[model samples]
Target chain A: MQRTIVFDVLNNDNGQVKAILGAKRFIEENPEYKLILVGQEEVIKNTLGKYAEKVEIISSNEIAHKVISPRDALRNQSSMLSAFNVLKEGKADAILSSGDSGSYITLASLKVKRLPNVSRPAFMPVLPTTTDKKMLLLDAGANLEIKAEYLNEWAKIASEFHKIIFKSNKPVVGQLNIGTEDYKGTEIAREANKLLKEQADNYSFKGFVEPSSAINGDVDILVADGYAGNIFLKTLESSFLGFAKLLKQIYMRNLKTKISALMIKKDLKGFKAKFDYRNTGGAYIVGLDKVVVKAHGGSDEVAFYNALNQIKIALDNNVIEKLKEVFEQAKEGEDE
Target chain B: MQRTIVFDVLNNDNGQVKAILGAKRFIEENPEYKLILVGQEEVIKNTLGKYAEKVEIISSNEIAHKVISPRDALRNQSSMLSAFNVLKEGKADAILSSGDSGSYITLASLKVKRLPNVSRPAFMPVLPTTTDKKMLLLDAGANLEIKAEYLNEWAKIASEFHKIIFKSNKPVVGQLNIGTEDYKGTEIAREANKLLKEQADNYSFKGFVEPSSAINGDVDILVADGYAGNIFLKTLESSFLGFAKLLKQIYMRNLKTKISALMIKKDLKGFKAKFDYRNTGGAYIVGLDKVVVKAHGGSDEVAFYNALNQIKIALDNNVIEKLKEVFEQAKEGEDE
Candidate 1:
């Protein structure tokens, strides 16, 4: 079976040519997959070379500029919007973009039908943790205001994806809060905590977790209101980057330290590799019918290639189909 | 100009004996100051030695256990409560304790009156950044629910303290949000953003900032609602600690990296010292009548010594009195 991915090859910082480079490499490796390249038609054809004859290209030079309102995304005639249109028309099995997150989330939510029982979609990203296992953090910045039911809904959907992505039988789900105590956070967090506990049969529920829990890799699927989750994600990213920069300064201090750095450069490289964005690919714009992913804005050819593979992993495991089955079955039971 | 500090030498994880050791050192160094030690009388006298003759000891063996409600702290007969009472009755210039945070906050706010025009108190900690400067982060978990005014109120009070502590006349202030965009985050965040911008004369306001701003030391005082501020603080600390642990694992993997680690051991120690809790000493429970500082739970002699010095800087600078004058003068203007 051939799977087609709608690749929005414009709006990324690195330019369309590099994105096209990524697409060409992706097609060469995965012969069974089809590509729907949406960007400058001439550039796409020119860069793709030998693979140009195989993949379909949509001529769209207009890139989606970051917009304040979600409604504005639908009205735009940008390449990102055009790509979403292709996915909406069922011309592709999955969609990937390195466009503006706000616009991408808007288009994904508006164009793609929600999975059964999912009221609002969440931004889910598989993040590297201290442990060998990767952790899935959701609502990374999509919904700032959420209700208690949203947590329960997102948890049920995310747990299914966690099982597929991490291959864990019963992934531990934790609600991010200011503290682990029962009465530690806002009313919404506490309310969500009680709601998650009641219907937590499908996965393991860790009532409330603090930032240390995320750092220690104490939970598998960490769910939070978009505000806290997004801040946590950004803080974690910037802290690690900042720490690495500081570490670099230490190693470059003097000849003695510089020699010490050279002596163990390979091990340091290996440590750095653990945090490579290539490994995690991009964040999944989850709870939609299609396998929609938002690639990093600064993604290079290698990053895009890995992101395409990430979407492939989701499609191969039939994660959306599995989630639909579970939620639909639960609905049927309630109706009965 | 003799000053007295009601030292609550209990409820810390390190035990009362360690706290007494810290107080003993503090009293020895600062001969002009008096310590109203609240703990087992025999232990306080026995440990303080020569300094015991100079200081006052409030005999209270019970430690302030963590409480669910603010009212519960008022009812407790713990040494922390006794210490608060000492500050309450105009017996001490300031107070220090390594007690339960919630309980301490409750006692501090209830026992000590709020500064003029100050509606609520906040937790302010001096945090280390990559730059040589230290940052002041407030509302670190005191108010989970906040209005637009709380941020402005906290900012004014924190700015005064920042000036006293860091000796910066025009410290840069920033509001921590999900994003720096004007349109991002909740209604309160946007409203607070506007409110802060309007009355940001005391300190240089940097509108909205992300976690990177804090990590890079781009701002001096980062203000937020208790929930977000607390999460950011915890995440920043745990991330630094987590990275260190990971770095340690890398160094211990083999003999070569181990030798390299030894070669750069002193530099690493210097880096670690930059984040020592002992140096920052403790978190100041701001917006109160007196200088109320809650020391780190695991504080040793040096940490306690530094925390005492932190209080001295505040008292010596007359931060609380200066804040009172500023707010009172502002209130009088509003009435006129």
Candidate 2:
């Protein structure tokens, strides 16, 4: 299949550099794939250098920054919208961004085409876990609040992705809660458990999983609402930093400890490498018609390389095509 | 000062045996303190054994498990409430429990007492950073939904405790949010930032902290609502386990890695010790009239010993008295 990946550059940040580099690499490696970079004219040209022909400057004045609220994206004729417009017009196969996640999500959902039967699209980040692997946590920050039924849908969607990408025959899907029991969480958890139990064949429906076990690679798909998922992601990010900071403090204490640290730098590096989010590709806003992936705000060149690889994974797995089929199947089953 | 510590056990699993040992040690160390063990006749007798004279067993049919919900504690008249009654009658200076955290907090608040100028009590857990040094995080699992104003109060309360115990001249208090800036987070964060800015002296209110950087050991007091804090605590707990699991998996990958792991067992042990929650004592229910600490549900003998040490710290610091003084001072300032 031919691949045409576009970067909707709302600002001149590390994301833009990454998208361009990733696109260039993709074209060089895959021959059949085309890469397009869209942003301000002078900025895109300057960033692309000799590869300026492959990159397209759409010339967008609307800027989306961390300060810019999601509502602002709706009012402004932003680059974000322009990038999605290209996708809608079949100019690009997918859009990858490391910009404002909220604004981009809102723009993609409203302006870009949404897949049928997806009431709310989820920004799912496949986070690395301590169990020497990773799990796909859905709705990392898409919907603020979640319902049990919606969570059921999230479980199905995430499970399908796991089966398609990871090739798990019956990927285990667990609901994120405080405890691992049928009646562990608040009202939503209990109801979701009931719904998952009824459709046990399609999903593993592994009851409740505590936060500690959720990222242990014990489950393939972890389902949570946007609010909880966002908190989870931020907390995980903070905890890694906290642990790193603590280690740095201990190593810096006096001359004796500093010597001990030098002896273990290799071990510490191995540890740090395990939790580095940059190695993982951008998070996908699943349940959209076209592939939309959100990169980290502080993503560097290497991280963009990871994102490019992830886009291929999504493309090869037929993420969009599988989603449409599953949602339609769910609806048809419900109608019966 | 004369100290009378009460231990109530009904339906407790080996609690009487543990409490008896703990009581005997305390009596042997500090002759000024008295130990009152409240539980069943035969079980308490068996636990008391040779130290039966030092331990006083008051007959009570109340059992509090970590799994028991608040409603069960409320409905079971003899269980948690009866233990609280022991504290109310001036029989005990503090109540120590290896039981449920929720029950301990609720019973301690409604039955024993509620502190002045405090609407709801909160649990403050000290978490270790990577360097193995610990920082205090408040509302670990007490208040589910709280406003920015409540966060300000929580910060104040946490600051006072840290000041008294940790003896930091100017305790830095930070509101946990998604990012560090003048403007960020949900509406609650914005309001809390405004209040914290005004009372900079009383607290070293260090604007906002990103979730990733919040537990960096730089901030003396980290404050948030219970729900978010609980999730944060859980995530931290899980991430550590995840890292450990991943390391173990890497070690088991082949013979060469297993040999490297064998050489690093001592270093790994040191690293694991730093992440141990048992070293940080137990969580204290702040904004309460009396100091009540909740041990981890799966706490062993070592954790209980830490809880005892925490009780000592609270009493020595006079946290409850300091809270009264703070409330009065704030009230007077408001009135003026």
Candidate 3:
């Protein structure tokens, strides 16, 4: 049976037409998957051309006009709401978007709703460490002001998400902080640390993991408030880019170094790929009723394909169903 | 013409005797500068042997016993207080310590006091970016809770420090945040951004700088609350260490890669030196009445020497006096 995957393509860096057309090959390759393009009908027909007939189109006039910022995108929410409505009405199995993340989250939470006992959904992205391991960082940018209870809930959600996705038992959860000491962060972190410790039987709670150690890839899941988590993610991205730029300058210094660079070009590519965010497809908005993957706004064709594959995995694995069961069991235990 | 530098050696990672012995060569080389060792008398004699006579000693049994953590170091501050007392009595020009930073900061602020109109002092460290540029990051770990007013004053202090150290006429100051947008951070960051904008005439305010962009060497000064600033510094350190480990694994993979690594050993060393924290010495405690450089607890002999050189530069430039003059003028403006 072919499962339908709806992609919102209104607010990406590349125009809607380009982003939609770029996904043509992905739709063609995944014949078992049904592609539903949700945006302006005329533009989809004009840009998608003959292939427009191969995929379903959900026309939306509300988001046709340009939105200047994420805040603006949230105000005009026609396309996102329509796409999410497809999932709400059982017409689609999953939703993928490269548009404004804040808008996607806001719309999804309103229309799709959260799982039982979950206050807010977190943006969980899997980032590759220097080693062979990959760690899931949560609350990447979903909520600005996070309470200790939010971090506590995020930990439980992330642990379940990792187990289902990575098939890991007893995953280590660490609270992100400036230092590894138990007493080394803001008031929220301190309170969260205590909560994590109390729930040690549920998950393996590692003490505070510094930002630097977090990248080393030892911990299974790193939890933080949106502000700190977003800063850490951006800093890692910038550092890798900066380092790549430095390597380019070094290799291009003289003909001798250029020859050396050419000799080890294959090895260098493998090394660089380990730090590329595109390889992970996209960050998942966990704790939601439906699977929502927010692909990077600047994603290319290949990156977009990877993001689609991520949704396929989530739907196939029944991740949300499993999480709901876990939360319900925990709620019942508390009631007892 | 001679200036006396008091070195506190009680709570360093290496024992007090070993740290004192490590600086013997520095004392011998700088014949014009007097070295005052502040520690237990018996320990100094046991370590210095014959050369103990050449250097002055300020013995204190108060810090003879062991102190375990930074909190403990703060409470047991005999050696630190003794060293600061030398500065207070007009007997020493500068003070250097490798003990607990919290202890050093607390003792310095209490005895030395802050400059006029300065509410809180900051720990400003110079770090090298990917480029040839070096940046000053303030409130590195000085205050756990920072107000917007502190950031405003720290910017003024950093601008003056940059002028004296880097010889820049107008230093570009950037507020550290998760994003560069005006509406992209916490309430404190939003307020600080406005304050920085208003004081644009005092310095070249470059607006908010992301942690990633901050390390690219574009801005002269990067300011943040203690929590974010400390995390950024630690993350950079951890990332560099992680990258180096990855490179080692890559180079040691096979004989061919090993041969290639040998060919670029010199180039790699130069590249690594550019990001070395030791090259810029230790971080300075700015806005204090006297010069205090908190050298790294694990600093080697060479790193300690560089830290001493930093103090020499600050003294020669009369940084504290210049900062007082600037703050006094600003106070007058506020009154008017």
Predicted structure with the largest lDDT when compared to the true one: 1
Q: Which candidate is the best by TM-score?
A: 1
Whole-model alpha-carbon lDDT for candidate 3: 0.80
Q: lDDT, candidate 3, residue B106?
A: 70
Clashing pairs for model 1 are none
Give TM per candidate.
Answer: 0.98, 0.86, 0.91
- Ordered from best to worst DockQ, the candidate numbers read 1, 3, 2
lDDT of 1 by residue, A1-336 (tens): 788999999878999987888888889989999999999988988898889998999999899988788778888789999999999899999999999999998888889999887789999988888778788899999998899988998898888888887788998999999778897788888999999998897799999999998878999899999989999999999988988989999999999999999988998886787787777779998888899999999999998988898888889898888888988987897799
Ranking by lDDT: 1, 3, 2
Cα deviation at A78, candidate 3, in Å, is 6.3
- DockQ of predictions, in order shown: 0.87, 0.37, 0.56
Q: How many residue pairs clash in each candidate?
A: 0, 10, 0
lDDT string for model 2 (A264-323, tens) is 556557677767878766788887778788878777767776787778777777888988
Better of 1 and 2 by lDDT: 1
Judged by lDDT against the true structure, how good is candidate 1? 0.89
Looking at model 2, what is the TM-score of chain A?
A: 0.91
* Model 3, position A285: C-alpha lDDT score: 91
Q: Which CAPRI category fits model 3?
A: medium
Query: Of models 1 and 3, which has the larger DockQ?
Result: 1
Instruction: Please give the CA lDDT of all the candidate structures.
Output: 0.89, 0.72, 0.80
